[model samples]
Target: MWSLTMRASTSVAPPGAKTTMTLIWRLGNSWALRGAAPATSRATAAAIRRFIPIIPLPVDGVGRPSLRFIGRNAFQKGPSTVSETENVFRPATPRPAHEGNGMPQSGRTDGPKDPYLLASLHRGLEVLDCFGARNSWSLADLSTHLGESKATIFRVLHTLEQFGYLAKDAATGRYAPGLGLHALGAAAVRHEQLRWQALPPLQDLAESTGETVHVGILHDGVVVTVQIVDGTRAVRMHSAVGKRSPAHASALGKVLMAYLPDGEVDAVIAAQGMARFTERTLTTPGGLREALHRARLDGYAQDEEEIEAGLRCLAAPITDHSGRPTAALAISAPASRMDPARVAALVPQVKATALRISRMLGSPSMAAA
Candidate 1:
């Protein structure tokens, strides 16, 4: 229910002209009166104030105006120069939660009522949601999907492109998911409990072997390093956390690839070609298949200067509860420090650390194996 209050005042136009009366109307708590004239006669204004009536009206819809009071007593015997009018409606109150179909009672699903829900942001997320199986979207296609104007959709697309969440083609003007989104996905994958649980053991391994240790997971045919423990050696290998390397060239990558299904392995290899990083890097399909077979048989993989010259990496698979290789633990060192004999000695230690991590993940098959 809404209540209306009316105020009256008299103003003189000229010496010989008649008096003018101004009526100021205010609606409910949401609106206020503006441009009201000053009282000319206190007694007459008081009399007018006494007869002012507060009318109650029903609020039917959002931003809907109430009925105007047009009764006989709405105007009094006065002059005709009631100039200047200002009527501004306040923002309407949201209806009760139960009144709308599946509308949240709190005006928000996640938190308390927030009047300033940015529509542009909501629409931008909706635009991102349109890029699932299709992979790319044009302005017209996004506008059609979202039922928004082309101008609005263009602005949203440009903003997303600027932030690197979406990439736009210069010639085609189509947009796809960008590298920034993949970075965010990689960060999320690292945030899993396994990374934290493996930190202590990885650190211990690095200290024991005096070589850099890494924990990485497969993402989009690449191995993304989630955790890194630098070795105590002065000339140790240095790799950033979130660094990505080819699955066929790095030991961590090969171990992870070896455990995936045959079809998935073929797809990953197809998507990420076997680019030869070094002379020792496997470039042919048959060579990579043989290496993966050896990794599966030995429960570990080796990178003999495959990714980078003068560097070697040995990796063992860390399995999940389903015995799936969700991550790999690797130790990296200079070729001079990790010679064939040293690698052979450290292989058992790397496998033991990996098995401990798999056990921590509650892998029944790993426990049996």
Candidate 2:
């Protein structure tokens, strides 16, 4: 694998200016991040904003590129040379893949070409991508999405399973992602802007209500906490950052999902199979839709013991500069303390903090600078 690392440096002294950020892109073998340096500043880094995967091209004409690079193969296979395994370990300048039509052009290969190997690896990545937001998967779904043969996908799955990158559900015969993959993903997101930006609001909400405050983002059709602030109370609540909850079950999740277009919301619900978490939980798709409708009308969402047996929550969406709510801020506490009157009182403060963070992110709001 080729490693491309770009480091930004302040060229010269500009009055009252500082090196605002540094982006570190470390390419690793086996498709993962190995290590990283300390954070300098969040403002200047470009790569940290998002780590877009470098598109992998195949040696054979399997994957195709778009019109902009119509003839360019996403993967380039170099000339095969007779070398020992030890000799093959050395790095060489990688050539771009061949492109003819809008597809990767393959040459007549009697054996496995380097490009084909890389392309196969990339396809395997695509298969891995399919298992996001869920813990398990079925073979048929993986095959259908990747357009790869079941046998090939099974082989890849077996390898990933062995490597602890994937897990097989014994009861359902479905394959879901493993913990190791999640660890890597968690590491990546820790470097993300949204994660860092969420911390202050989370802390503020927690301090204000003396309850657990969570900052969740929509992922894989559900709302998941990207950051959390534990409460000050002795019996304070605790939640893991990556814990997944139904969009309709948690105040945070529903309010964030409510901001999405109706079609998107319906699609997510359809795919996830809206199940009631409690008697108070939204039991039907229609009911969930109505809840979302209410949330939009009131600019907030409420979960009255919808998920946990004795928990109550209130949430407000956090928007970007364009006013698109990509995340939500929520405070959750035991129902005994977070009664309807208390929850109602906290709504304005939660909304204010959300708006504060939104304004910090350049969100267009009455509170924005």
Candidate 3:
């Protein structure tokens, strides 16, 4: 029920000069340390250690600090009445049900003490934890499961609904996990599957073509590289996993955009304007549309120094079981090594690798079609 705020400020002098850090802990109207000395750069840890001892913390018989909240009455007595509240400060005897371990009945470590922890936030999470085994929950159901009052559970549910973490049925007043949770779970699953399936082919493609290979997915109109295999060539193009690139200018992005619906592609272009990265970058809508048309027809996409000067890339789409382009696999190389003849030769190899990955994902092939 109490609110606590903490802020830290650091002052750095010129190179080789001493740095000073000030930690401010505010509890409502009171400051825990009014004019504590600024901690030097080297002695910050020592300063914190010095401050912790004066905190009047309760330690167990073994000499370790025991952090447990008694009640609001304990805080009301203040620091001067420490001796009188010694019994209140001692760790509460664990319930009979959780006797083996020192942990509470919930099997969770008593997290931070009450003053620093938000009871409401913890209750809200407890409500969410209940939904793991079921599709939906009513207020009474969550209240009983968490052993919290119905009114408290209702407030938590309402807050979760407002944040799109839960959706409430208008007719039944029941709550279920929302689209936000589904989106997060789906993204995690898709990324894991894509990386697992793409790694082998990516490594093979890199070794065969002697060029850097990447597996990327479109997220929020950007190409997020999920996996990468560096080429054997000493001067090959370099890129790292988890790097994000403009979806409009990269081959991996273009291949993904090519397979997506026209409306979605337009939405991406509208949201992330076609910022030119090089002279060859397609900045106009009509030009990009034409390029996508070519990519769709040729079953692959090409980037000729569009994203970065002196670099060339070719990419093909990896489809999911539903036949949707879930990710793209691409090969990148220096322009000198990826001349027109070399690119033409590599195109089929990239497309083949992509098709193999798509089949692994359970997408039907042209022969089946």
User: Top model by lDDT, which number?
Assistant: 3
**TM-score, predicted candidate 2 vs. hidden true structure:** 0.51
The Cα local distance difference test for each model comes to 0.74, 0.67, 0.75
Candidate 3 Cα deviation (angstroms), residue 5: 26
Local error of candidate 2 at residue 327 (angstroms): 0.1
Per-model TM against the reference: 0.53, 0.51, 0.61
Candidate 3 regions off by >4 Å? 1-152, 155-187, 366-369
> Between candidates 1 and 3, which one is better according to lDDT?
3
Clashing pairs in 1: none
RMSD score of candidate 2 (Å) = 20.5
**Which parts of model 1 have CA positions greater than 4 angstroms off?**
1-191
By TM-score, the candidates rank as 3, 1, 2
For residues 3-95, could you state the per-residue lDDT of candidate 1 as single tens digits?
A: 444332233233323222233333332222222345469887676556543222322222122223333343232222222111212223443
> Which lDDT tens digits does candidate 3 get at residues 1-369?
554322222332344332222222334533242122445675775765554422344333332233445555655534433455465455542333324443223323244356676767877776776677778988987666555678988889999898888999999989999987788788788789889888998899999888899999999999999999999988988889889999889999998899879999999999999998889999999999999999999889988999899999999998887788889999999999888899889988998898888887778652254
- What clash count does candidate 1 reach? 0
Q: Pairs clashing in candidate 3?
A: none
- Which whole-number lDDT from 0 to 100 does residue 177 have in model 2? 80
Model 3 clash tally, residue pairs: 0
Best by TM-score: 3
